[model samples]
Target: MRTPFFLILDAIIFIDVSGCQWRLLPKEYPK
Candidate 1:
């Protein structure tokens, strides 16, 4: 199944706040 738009957005916000690389995102999130 395709990832949801809001979930992707959440991932982006999380990355921005955490200052982490995209590859470091949790397994539950899309790349």
Candidate 2:
């Protein structure tokens, strides 16, 4: 399934702020 830009941005921000690895981001469909 396709993913949303906002979701990707949020994931990046969250990872940056929380210092979480990119691979640790949620796997759920963005849209």
Point to the candidate with the largest lDDT.
1
Model 2 residue 16 CA deviation in Å: 0.1
TM-score against native, each model: 0.50, 0.49
Q: Give the alpha carbon lDDT tens digit for every residue of 1-31 in model 1.
A: 5579988998989978566555466764556
Which window of ten consecutive residues has the lowest lDDT sum in model 1?
A: 21-30
Q: Write the per-residue lDDT of candidate 2 for residues 1-31, one digit (tens) a residue.
A: 5469888998889878565444356554243
Q: What lDDT score is found at residue 1 in candidate 1?
A: 56
Model 2 misplaced regions, further than 4 Å: 1-3, 20-31
Q: For model 1, which pairs clash?
A: none
Model 2 clash pairs? none
Q: What RMSD, rounded to one decimal, does every model reach?
A: 8.9, 9.7
Candidate 1, residue 30: Cα displacement in angstroms equals 29
